[model samples]
Target: MTTSAATTTETPSVSQTKTGIRFWRRLCRNRLVTVGLVIIALQLFTAVFAPWLTTYDPTAQDLAVKELPPGSEGHWLGTDEYGRDMWSRLVYGSRISLLVGISSVVLGLVGGVVLGLLAGYYRWLDGPIMRLVDLMFAFPGILLAMLVIAMLGTRLINVVIAISIWSVPTCARIVRGSVLSLKDREYVQALRSMGAGDGRILFKHLLPNCAAPIIVFATMRMATAILSTSALSFLGLGAQPPTPEWGAMIAAGRDYMWTAPHLTIIPGVAIMLVVFAFNVVGDGLRDALDPHMDVTYES
Candidate 1:
């Protein structure tokens, strides 16, 4: 009996190790995903080590040296109209963008998952919740966010709240679909027959099954959140001046575009790269996780 139990435990351990190895092999097979991972890693590194990477304060202004071109003394990417170091601002700005993106998505995910669980699992709640989701979906995301910001007044945290609220419908829809499909599966039916409580069945079984799609959607939505944050900042409704946000920096540099294109171009490139990286990574994750995809392994 002892030997049999030990063998059973060892078999599961070996199976789990093979599963993990297969996942990594599939992930590495996608070239675009590899590139995206590298870019994302670099952005994270920049956000975490901004202080050590740059000598100039992002908010510090030297009016006398305004609009210094790229490759100018000390300032590699050059100075904006405010004469603040572009490189430093870009480095620090990554922190704000990533923070807002991640936090807002998490907030949305929590709320969305709860609502979706109710909508999917309970027949009585489905119609009402779906109608509410439809109402939210009627408005464009950014427009809804702007309206919320207008009503709530502009602040960093307010921006996050607005974005989170705007994101709820999308997340809810995704999760509800996943839950609807999962709730009727044999495993869920078996659990129901086994007298599993609603909470236990939903939380332990349904939610865990919905994780892959939710993760992919969240990754993609993060890019959208970053873009929305930048747009709001550009419109003067997000981060205030001297905060070293990329969008605000671009807005500040727009007037001097003819004379110092680097100011606008550099930050624009940074935003583009980050968004693109997230999108590619999301695609990669979807492909890797998709059971329908015929993923090949190298022998």
Candidate 2:
């Protein structure tokens, strides 16, 4: 007990730095993680350098070249019904998808962490917060998002807000569970006994301990958030037409599916690849971060 408190109170940075190094080393050792990282890196690179990667403006139109097949003239992935360059829109669309995914996760994380900390630390707050979370959980994730969007009205930012609100329940529950398990630990008790304030104890000590699950949740949530954003856009509750968002593009192309399959196929493939990349990466992180997740073979 003394040793743990001493370690927790003293040299936290040094210990954390060493632990992070070990964690990263273990993470990089997985081949699946390597592949996930490569895919994520490529998507990030494409998102960042979208303009340079594709010459045509994503929104520009030319009726003469509309609905062309892949490899038609300068349009490598072909043009949509509006003659908008599919490749350009796709590259640009990465920015929107990644942006929305990251933003909503961050917002949800903030709200969840606050609610979780309060609920776990304060006996009086637990019931109310948990009940609120339960209320949120009563609705399916997509349906909850839809409800929020219904009230907020459709737009890119609205999509992020709706998704973040939908995300709060799961994130809060995960964090609350972690806090419940951790709040009674020797280190936490020691901190409390040492006259540490709640803020310091919760944020400085408890938060760090809860990081692994939160990180795993956030990573997995990224895929869901991105998918949700696309789903909303597909359903016309997200980025409107002429915006070139992947989901909007998919929605637009559904009408031309019989005549111009590439319009739908290309963007759909992008969503699939991005979502798969995040899922694999999230899984890898979960395995690496979870100390009790060892697999054993019985004789």
Candidate 3:
């Protein structure tokens, strides 16, 4: 009996490991996913080692050397209008972009999950929470962000808050739909019949089953969060000047577009790459998580 119980106890862990390995294999089968992973890894590495990656202080300015072209003497990738090294500012900007993206997604996902869980599990709360979610969803993400920023005023933290709030409605809907399907499943029903409390049933049993969609949603949402942050900054409602944020850098470089186009081009390309990476990875994740896609994927 003890041996049988031991085997049963180990089965779930072993099955989970096998599932994860299968997911990884499926994800890596796509060459674009490989490229996306490499880009994301490099971006993370750059953000962590930003100080050492570039010698110049990103915020420091020198009028004398301002607007120097790329590969001109010690400064490579040129200097912005403020004469700060573009390389350094770009490197440091990765830190801001990643921080905002991750922070906002986490906050949004948490709020969304809680609301979704309550709405899904308790029939009484469903109408009110879903109506609130509907109201939020009525506006575009950028518009919602603009309204939030207008009310709260602009700061990096406010950018996070705005983006997070924007994210919540989408996330909530995703999770709510997932939960509605999962709550009536046999495992959840079994847990409920076994006298497990609602919290345990909701969090322990139902949540795990809902994870695949959430994971895919969050991965895609990161791209939107980063892009939105940059957009707001570009409009002068996000990061202030001298912050070395990619959007702010582009905003400053707009005046020099005719002469030193690299100022805008460089950061624009960075934003494009980062957004592309996240999107491709999100697609890969969606494919991997969806059982329907499994038969289509090359072995």
User: How does each model score on lDDT?
Assistant: 0.90, 0.89, 0.92
Q: Report the C-alpha displacement of residue 38, candidate 1, in angstroms.
A: 0.7
TM-score of each: 0.96, 0.91, 0.94
Best by lDDT: 3
lDDT by residue for model 3 (168-261), tens: 9888888888888888888878888889999898888888888998999999999998999899999998999889899998998999999999
lDDT (10s digit) by residue, model 2, range 1-299: 99999888879889889778867777777887888889899999999999789999889998989999999788889999988888999999999999999999999999999999899888899999999999989999899889888998998898999999988988888888888998999998998888999999899988998898899999989999999999999999999978879998999999998999999999999999889889988988987787753332111
TM-score, predicted candidate 3 vs. hidden true structure: 0.94
Model 3 misplaced stretches (Cα beyond 4 Å):
1-14, 295-299
- Over 97-197, each residue of candidate 1 has an lDDT whose tens digit, in order, gives 99999999999999899999899999999999999999999999989999999999989899999999888888888889999888988988999899999
Clashes of each: 0, 0, 0
All candidates: CA RMSD in angstroms? 1.6, 4.5, 2.1
Candidate 1 local Cα displacement, residue 202, angstroms: 0.6
